[model samples]
Target: MAATNFVRGSVLKCSFPYVDRPSRPGPHPHYCLFVDSFEIRDRIYYAVCYGTSRLDEPLLENHNGAIFSVDSSLIKGSPMSMRVTHFVCSHVAVIPDRWVYRNFQARLDFIRPEGRKGDRLRERMYDQFVLLEPLMEYEALIAVNYVRKTGRPGLPGETTLR
Candidate 1:
């Protein structure tokens, strides 16, 4: 089947589109995908971090290009839900550590609220990361409910959502 516009359970690879901001910006606005999943040893690996290392590469190897924002009002609601989970697999015994993967995972997890650290599928992951930017609609996929409930009414770096 062809990819759906808003896919549920299936992770999407998307990027930030360049917008004309009043101030002069970089040659191009940097882009990052919503998230991705990799399958190894019958288990799936999901990642949302930028790269192997801040030093290795700011961007990862398989990253697909950006997904520009679409107006939510343009489309009516549907029964389905598209989920985004961000987590790093903790090191397990017997296997040597994957330094790059673990490092970025720790960075993303650090953004999680103190009480809710550990595990990806848990609702706590939803709370801490999603509410980080209450008004950031596009990135809101990860924590729409947490934001609707407790978000302080503003987008990241902006004063108020309104």
Candidate 2:
């Protein structure tokens, strides 16, 4: 699919940067929701909220649904909230075609109200609209398999070395 197809309320997974210390080392691939977009000249960027899966945090599991949230901080010591946390909706990025992975394992449609809070965050995160890569079958398989067996996508710090 074209990057244009990724409209508001789209749920996705990518190598999202840290909220506070975005450049610092941490998780590579994080689940995110598409909030809003803007165009700077001819390029576009999407604002997204990086997700968390800290064991000590509260969680909301919408297994059958396409979207969900957790209660943990994206920043290490931040106070816990009712929504997916410890994390922040602070990414303005253009997902390249090579990095796009189609996750047939999960497909979601989040309209207004259902994802109102998240949409607001996304709008706040970015003001530029840009194109992104389409999903790759192979990458989707890796993610799907992991979610199928583990009930979640693999996070940073988890060894892929077998």
Candidate 3:
């Protein structure tokens, strides 16, 4: 695959392999936020925090200082919309560039708001991935801090492309 550049704060849709259910037929599709990227021995790697809509049950208790929620309104051009989407900062994953290029679906982009200089920014749009409005500067800062404090590095699921 050719070299592709992804910016921080970009939201990506990827096929995330199930960590607990290796017997499952295939990987499950999921939305994740692009946080950081680096190159190791000429191979690129991405660090992302996966987002989930399961606000109740087992995942609910996981929402504490490290989780942040994005409302549907903040997300545009998605085929489907959940009432709210939560990203788990502690559930960080570092995946190979090959896997990311192969299983990639869509990504989020920023849209600048119109009107006066002080006017709030408008919702953003993207081509394939769900178009998500960029998080406010403060929100991004909080997320970064949380991820830095709690993020555990690992490829928690299948690492190779099947």
Best by TM-score: 3
Q: What TM-score quantifies how close candidate 1 is to the native fold?
A: 0.21
For candidate 3, the per-residue lDDT at 65 reads: 40
Model 3 spans > 4 angstroms off: 1-4, 21-26, 76-83, 101-162
lDDT of 3 by residue, 1-162 (tens): 214576645566654434453223126556777666654456555666667887554454543344555555555444434666776554555555544534344333233233113423323222112322233232334433433443422344332211
Compose the digit string of candidate 1's lDDT tens values, residues 79-112.
1122222211110001101211221111122233
Better structure of 1 and 3 per lDDT? 3
| Candidate 2 TM-score to native | 0.37
Candidate 1's clash total is 4
Task: Give candidate 1's root-mean-square deviation (CA, Å).
Answer: 18.8
Scanning candidate 1 in windows of ten residues, the lowest lDDT window is 88-97
The lowest-lDDT stretch of 10 consecutive residues in candidate 2 is 127-136
Question: Between candidates 2 and 3, which one is better according to TM-score?
Answer: 3
Q: Tens digit of lDDT per residue, candidate 2, span 1-162?
A: 225556543555656544343323234665555444433334443344444554232222221111233323221222323345322232233333233344411222223334335665433322211112112122233333333454332222231210
Task: Rank the candidate models, highest TM-score first.
Answer: 3, 2, 1
Ranking by lDDT: 3, 2, 1
